[model samples]
Target: MKRIWNNSWLQKGLRNSTFMQSKSPHQIDPELSDKLFSIVNDILPPDKQVKPRTGLLTFGDAPFHISQPNQHDTKAEFEHEYQIVTEAMAGLRKLVPLFLTREDADQQRTLDLLRLEFDAKMQQGAPETPIDVAIDLVRSVVADVGGLRASVRIFIDLFRALSERRDELEQQRDKFWNLPHRAPEYYARAIANRLAKLYARKTGQKPTSGASTDTGDASTKFTKALEQIFSLLDIQSGARPPADWAIKNLTEEDLAPRMSVLENLGLGPSPSRKGLSMSRCVLPEGPKD
Candidate 1:
């Protein structure tokens, strides 16, 4: 009897031969694979992480059925699948805050896992408090619920609080701002400013600065700087300020320089004394086209 080359046994033999020829070239390390699995495993729900029939060997849609027919390139396929898992993990990381706000058990589980991972990373020399954590919390929470405008407002509120606190502690700077944790605040401030710009682009309005009790020399300087920046933007665009553009309850003193991109938008202090307090911009009749 002649053996068929396309038979299962023959195909397995060919795959085995090919794999043996290059077994050491691109093998996935067991330790690294386990580490990647640990991260991926937490991103998915318990039931979805492992199939009943596969026990704990399967992860999401990627099965560890190494001996299955047509899965000839086992190592490459494994790595590719793991790469996809890592990408999913990255997305899940961003979505963790949303999940934490959810009431589902599966979501809470994923949130706890993410918090643990964040804590572990922090322990490894990363400053993970106040500026980093606080701003991120505001961003994820506000952006999830209130859209770009709300997110911008919440960021300004948080940034202003941090700035005020930092200013108060300036006399004790040797013990506070000098710490490594404060380093992240600088980056977070820059990110908040960028978010302010995004809000301006989305609404064609300057964001409320959320400056806490600014009625001093600092306030004057801030307002002047803000007006200068807004003037520059208007001049550079070669367009006059919108004829009908106007911000409510907000003067240059109440605006942040970074958020002065739109001088016509209106904003007011928060009524609730927490979060961002902002009033909607008043555009002239007939859509802001």
Candidate 2:
């Protein structure tokens, strides 16, 4: 009897053979593997670290699986992991401005398109938290790439590259001020004027050039005001507000009275709450096309 080769099996075997030939040595030194793992752990925070599966033989070229902490392991362990995740998300939120001001026009456009998709997802009642949105974005990208591990590896590599070139990235970000996308100087002046007004209102006197005010206290107040403004505008903290909603229109006095009324009614000035109304505050009609 003549033996015939299966076409699909032959193709698959060729592909696998080619892949193996192109890959590095099948086995890695145990010490070297451990050192590599240690380096990765040192580079990434706990939440972003990749863990190797124990009791399994892995080749040098094997893909690494990025796993989330098992929530069912223990309540204390879960809470600890939760805290790390929260801190990671907060750190990510702080990086939003840098992410938005990409030096490459293509990257900036890609991010803008992603934001549009995020907004559409939110409108469809997806979880509105930044963490949830981030997860959704990751899932979408993973799906597009056809492999979670590959997508995660790309992200990890990009993160490591960014960490190594933080200073260069910051310099590039500074150059974004010259771009016509947004006005950073105008916003800086607005924030400074607002802070000065708030300082004067609280102290019943204008701040002098050499006045010795508590720097920490002023910083805390400034942070709170910025948070409140972002919350009221239904935008992220580092994001630019809609052009129609002039920053000049939303004065401290305008919000102060409304905030007091909300406080009296056991509500805060949150865009999410039905109690808060744009009409109550001195805001423009709405964002234009």
Candidate 3:
């Protein structure tokens, strides 16, 4: 009797890891997992309470993924994840009754039955889910007379049903993923490219038009033009533009094209213009009375 109980415990442990790992803490039905945990915790001995630490179960690892948990931000988070593991174990215990009905099947018999059913499901490409297997066992019991034969037949049928359902879901998932994207996404990308081009044009250095020029002559001409405009406005200014304001290392040939670009942008030396007249001030008259 003791041996049979241990075998049942092993079966539950094996199922616990597989089932809990696939499900997230949110999926752990609050009422169901809590109820299950209460029952299993009461039934099992303290040492027998399986707390899978590493990547073996869902809770200790990432909450909603299959990856390993490298670190936890706080001790509370770490404790919470393990708590989920305990809850999952309870959830798994809820399925045992669907299979083990009679008191006759001893340890070896029960183990063999579960192992065979698990292998049968794997052979048919159904995922190893203990809850699913237990559900299948219930159906198998109903289909045939309750015994070993019925268990075997039920497992085979269960595997086939799971495989068909998995295939159908995969087809639907593929269809949804392959659908065309929205038009606005493409339009947004195009607008972004155009804006980038405008920014580049505004900031990029424009190449000088001609390759060579007499630097001394061009410099003399530009200085004359600059001073002529200054004199016409009667404003005394520095002979050269500030180094910080424009290209300091510009060759005379390069300066000409850049100056032309500035001129086109309405920044070139303004046409030599006479200063405009200021408005004359008028005095207000006091009241005659």
Candidate 4:
């Protein structure tokens, strides 16, 4: 049992396969790991949990989808993300035998000292915890038990080589990313692109030129609207657009172009040709108080 259980492949995978300096904490200990494996083995169902689909459960779940149409829909999607996180954490809990920590140091110590007083209990074998009991076992894996740092370096290097191929493009991508964008026109174009993406995400289709956001109350309605707008405007946020965001450079024309640019890029929900022509389009609510 010990020979097969302490297989070399397991050691190589969990530590060297990833090329990290260390294995997951569970990788270090044998006895404690066995305990966790036993527990998780008991808890996991016969099959793995199936991923759900997009829109609804009919196609299986795609956890990243917005699914719904409003802010509340987005919030619901995030709540599902939380559920995924909690579920994964629960699985990790089952896979660990010693979940104790520095704060738990005293409790584990008490268990250790008590074992001394009642050595028979150690011989008899103790029960388990929901969190498992591996981490509190000991520090520093020895050469005999595959705890040597040299082995770790070998794995780390190999892992780095493998991952090096995977994310190599991700690294060099940033160099050419905005290289095409060096001038104010780049920012202008970017704002246009972002506006289209926003329109697509909200409506899931190309926006019409007639779909402009019409407000009845600027102070009340725009108070909430400005929070989203300033964030898009790349201005500092403090409950609302900063004084300088309003006074210094943020003019109606500056904001106006963004709307027209957005309509050109594709965020037009309004039918009017001047989709973002703010001066031509926006009329203040109720004569501004």
Per-model lDDT = 0.34, 0.38, 0.34, 0.32
Q: Candidate 2: where are CA atoms >4 Å away?
A: 1-95, 126-289
Query: Candidate 3 — which residues are off by over 4 angstroms?
Result: 7-147, 180-289
Q: In terms of lDDT, which candidate is strongest? A: 2
Q: Which is the winner by TM-score between candidate 2 and candidate 3?
A: 3
TM-score of each: 0.18, 0.18, 0.19, 0.18
Tell me the tens digit of each residue's lDDT in model 1 across 1-289: 2222346785465456543334443344455345434433443345434222332222222112111112223446544644554444344324322422234567657756765555443333222235333333433444345343343344334434443333333423432334554332232232233333333444345544322255422122222333333342232221112111222323444343344312212222232433221123221121223
Give a tens-digit lDDT track for model 3, residues 124-158. 43223353554344433443343443543344344
Model 2: per-residue lDDT, tens digit, 1-289?
Answer: 2223357875475456543334344455555456545543442436544455553223452112111111124446544644554444345324433322344678768866766665444344322235332344543445444342333334334433343234333333343433554344444333434434444344333332221155422133234344344343233423223221333444555334224423332223433454332233221111134
Candidate maximizing TM-score? 3
lDDT (Cα, tens digit) per residue for candidate 4, span 1-289: 1112346676465444432233432122334333323332232234422232223113221112211111223435545644554444344323222321113557667745643544433222222233122321211122223332223333333433333222332322342333463233222233333333333333334322211246422233223333333343353433222221222332333333224322322323343543323233221111122
Question: After best superposition, candidate 2 residue 288: deviation in angstroms?
Answer: 44
Q: Clash pairs of candidate 2? A: none
Error of 2 at 251 (Å): 23
Question: What TM-score quantifies how close candidate 2 is to the native fold?
Answer: 0.18
Model 4 CA deviation exceeding 4 Å by range = 1-181, 185-195, 201-204, 208-227, 236-289
Q: Worst 10-residue stretch by lDDT in candidate 2? A: 62-71
